[model samples]
Target chain A: MVRWEPGAEGRLQAAALNLYAERGFEQTTTADIAQSVGLTERTFFRYFADKREVLFAGQEHFEQVFLDGVAAAPAGASALDVVASALEAASAYFPDERRQHSRVRYAVISANPGLQERELLKMATLADAMARALQERGVDEAHAVLAAETGTTVFTVSYRRWMAEGEERSLAAVQADTLADLRALVLAAG
Target chain B: MVRWEPGAEGRLQAAALNLYAERGFEQTTTADIAQSVGLTERTFFRYFADKREVLFAGQEHFEQVFLDGVAAAPAGASALDVVASALEAASAYFPDERRQHSRVRYAVISANPGLQERELLKMATLADAMARALQERGVDEAHAVLAAETGTTVFTVSYRRWMAEGEERSLAAVQADTLADLRALVLAAG
Candidate 1:
């Protein structure tokens, strides 16, 4: 009988992360991850398509959060404002507790070209989704795309800071700060 | 005996594009491309690693144009200004002559997820390189990354416009228009 627990996915992810950190991502196997989680390999496949999916399982959920935030923004909000609100809401998903896990995952991802490619695609997908949401809010395609891309950059830079050692700021705070910096950069260019 | 001649790369690319357009990307084979170009399969391999590479052979040269532009910007130029100049310079590489080829290539790429992932990684790589160049010019890390990413977005939006049917404007013109739109979006959010 297959055992399905309330936190089976989390347990699998935690086990995968731990194994990846200890043995390196390339060295870790699916069976190792499953064994570490005290789950069958069949259960592992049920949650993730492969070992790589464990590291990126949150991408769809995160993209949905960003899209929802954009859709829920005030009707009168500017395109960039809607993106900022969306990024702010999305950042809340990465709490202080996730910093260490994120750091480990980042390291694993950075060392693998395949993982890096997936990461880029995930960000691109998020940007595309956000752009569509902005357009649905009556913004032009040009503005929508720019705002969505800018929002992704803000999230990336802020997330990097939030994951850095000795960095204690929340992801939302860092995102706001980076957004200000981007505004200054834009104004200076203009 | 191999018939090695000048413009072999260009010929191979043209043949690949024609074949891809006719038979679709997945259905076209490297042997067909080689035969169409009147070259041996070995000659095609010498020019491009694989079929997909024929469409992306100029990426390195394009990156060089952008980087050189960044490096040549005035000493007092802001990070964003450097990026703008880089983009302006890079836009010059995609002249009107390449528009049709670009459109066809875009269609082929859009139909394949693997190609889309590769395209996203290529853009990310460009952004990363631009950010590093900005950092080398004394820009702060946050500002550098934001400027680089925004520049990539500008290029993407402008390129799409330039590729659209019935669009006759120069790439530089489209890029300037998109940059203005981005500036307005940023200002509104600010």
Candidate 2:
């Protein structure tokens, strides 16, 4: 049993995503989101520090899972292998029910420069965390950083493909394909 | 004769860097920057769209040079080789006198999340552009993208090392080291 009930938080997220899609992220206010969700503005604030925070609440948890997975990877695994395993572990955390909402959120983020910047920052933070985790596993600093970056790039490309055409694909499958593509690309270049 | 006035842009960039470092990016207005150089705000705006633009104006010219260099790379040259040549060409365009201002600008940009995101987006855009350029030169799409990403990663790591404390190596030398590091990392992983 999950200790944390995904109730008001999830409701607020769904409400916020709908409103953001309907009225534009910039046009929507906290009060409006709270009112639509039949909650007080205070309730909304309790869940999200700010409007931007709503889009990023999952990042902390995701990063933790990713880092743990990397730390637990095989002793002799390469940095990329560690990161790839971590990405695979992280994939299970993304709920399938939220795919549509996730796509909408990405669309909104893509259109807004401020949101896009925040998204990039989040990704960079995740990469840095992963790099540090790899370093803890005896990987060299530069190799660890490169592996983290490559992993993030693979995730990015795979996520884009998964989101394209509004079609649903297993995160594991997409990630696997992305890694294969990366390996093939590198080999061909070599 | 060169069409553009030499060092005019450099002087403005230097002025902006000093003001940003002294008063912080948000606190230092464009007018403050222009006044420091004995120029008007209009002149500042003419050169830069906003305060942030001053830090990024050279990016376009740099990308153009890189793209041209990549295009002119020898047939059968490895993707890394092409990217390395492009980085070398781009390095020649970065004036030695700008190093101090460049460091100052990087410091300001690093401290601000907003600027950092825009910087990442710009780099992503450049990578995509470089991938497309490579594809146009007969490289497959997936391979081209991966090659471009690898090159960009090397460039980023090299630039960071160049900017790090007690690192007196030339940018070109740093870039070379980064490429070698990347190759070793990838090969070891494989």
The sequence of per-residue lDDT tens digits that candidate 1 reaches over residues B1-190 is: 7676799899899889888888989999899999987888898998899998888888889899999989889998988899999998898888899899899989988888778878888888999999999999988887888889889988987898899999999999998998888888877874
* RMSD values, in order shown: 2.1, 4.3
TM-score of each: 0.92, 0.87
Candidate 1 lDDT tens digits, A1-190:
6666779899999999888888888899899998886878888999999998899997878899898788778999988889988987888788889888889999888888788888888888898999898888898876787788878878887888888899999898888888888888888874
- Which residue pairs in candidate 1 have backbone atoms (N, alpha carbon, C) closer than 3 angstroms, thus clashing? none
User: Model 1 in CAPRI terms: which quality?
Assistant: medium
* lDDT (10s digit) by residue, model 2, range A41-91: 888888899998888888888799888778778889877778888988877
Q: For each candidate, what is the lDDT?
A: 0.87, 0.78
Residues forming the 10-long window of minimal summed lDDT in candidate 1 chain B: B181-190
Q: Report per-candidate DockQ.
A: 0.72, 0.42
Q: After superposition, how far is residue B160 of candidate 1 from its true place, in Å?
A: 1.6
**Chain B of candidate 2 vs. true chain B, TM:** 0.88
List runs of model 1 lying over 4 Å from the truth: A1-6, B1-5
Q: Which TM-score values does chain B get in all models?
A: 0.95, 0.88
